[model samples]
Target: MQCPRCHNLMVEQSFEDLRDDTGSLCFKGWRCITCGEVLDPLILSNRAAHREPMSGRARQKRSFIQIGS
Candidate 1:
């Protein structure tokens, strides 16, 4: 299969925790050889849901620590 994003040839790969979700399932997926993109049933679901990527703000609100002397 070809990657939708990169248009590169995809190879079959297997891994656990398909999309970083709290599930105990191992899945078979396709990975882009050029862009390192992963495409699987689980990943596709999350992508379709349009959930925010797991970067930048992991939490909804800002967190900080105060420094004192």
Candidate 2:
């Protein structure tokens, strides 16, 4: 599989959750070799559900107010 963040090759790997509350300790996921990004089933679903559409508006710059300088 290809990574979404870096567009690199991803490898299958097993991950262990030590403090799992659902009683499953081991899970299978994919990891990007270049960017070290991990993706699991739960993570993928959550991201898909919460995805937002991109807009054409440019971002505004913020001014920082320094105190006691």
Candidate 3:
């Protein structure tokens, strides 16, 4: 597949640790040789799952305050 960033050919490669958080992270993903862009589906889904949902009422109050000021 072509890279979204550089539009170059993406090569399938295995990596050790992309994030390098705590333990070793081993996953196979597509890598762009031209711009060094990595696309990993697992990481994307993991991030979405780990994302915090915003508080509705608090957010609304903050928005009102900002608008008034």
Candidate 4:
């Protein structure tokens, strides 16, 4: 899969959610190799529901802090 944020190669990875209320302990998601962005099924669905149309103007990319830096 391709990462939506960086247009890089994404690999499927398994993640463990210990405190999930849905009772599912493990789930699969895609992780971007370049930008370290993660996308799961729930997150994709939420974004789709609240997605807005893109404007003609270009937007600047915001810098993000790496968790384990």
Q: Write the per-residue lDDT of candidate 1 for residues 12-31, one digit (tens) a residue.
A: 99877735567577888999
Judged by whole-model lDDT over C-alpha atoms, candidate 2 comes out at 0.81
lDDT of 4 by residue, 1-69 (tens): 999888999999998887757675888999998999999988989988976655422222222234334
Highest-lDDT candidate = 3
Better of 1 and 4 by lDDT: 4
Q: lDDT value for candidate 3?
A: 0.85
The 0-to-1 C-alpha lDDT of every candidate, in the order given, reads: 0.78, 0.81, 0.85, 0.80
Give per-residue CA lDDT, model 3, range 39-61, as digits (tens). 88786688678865578768988
Can you rank all candidates by TM-score, best first?
2, 4, 1, 3
For model 1, which pairs clash?
A: none
Candidate 1: residue 15 Cα off by (Å) = 1.1
Off by over 4 Å in 2: 20-24, 53-69
Best by TM-score: 2
Over 4 Å off in model 3, which ranges? 18-23, 46-69
Judged by whole-model lDDT over C-alpha atoms, candidate 1 comes out at 0.78
C-alpha RMSD of candidate 4: 7.3
Candidate 1 wrongly placed segments (more than 4 Å): 18-24, 46-69
True lDDT of residue 28, candidate 3: 83
TM-score of each: 0.52, 0.64, 0.49, 0.63
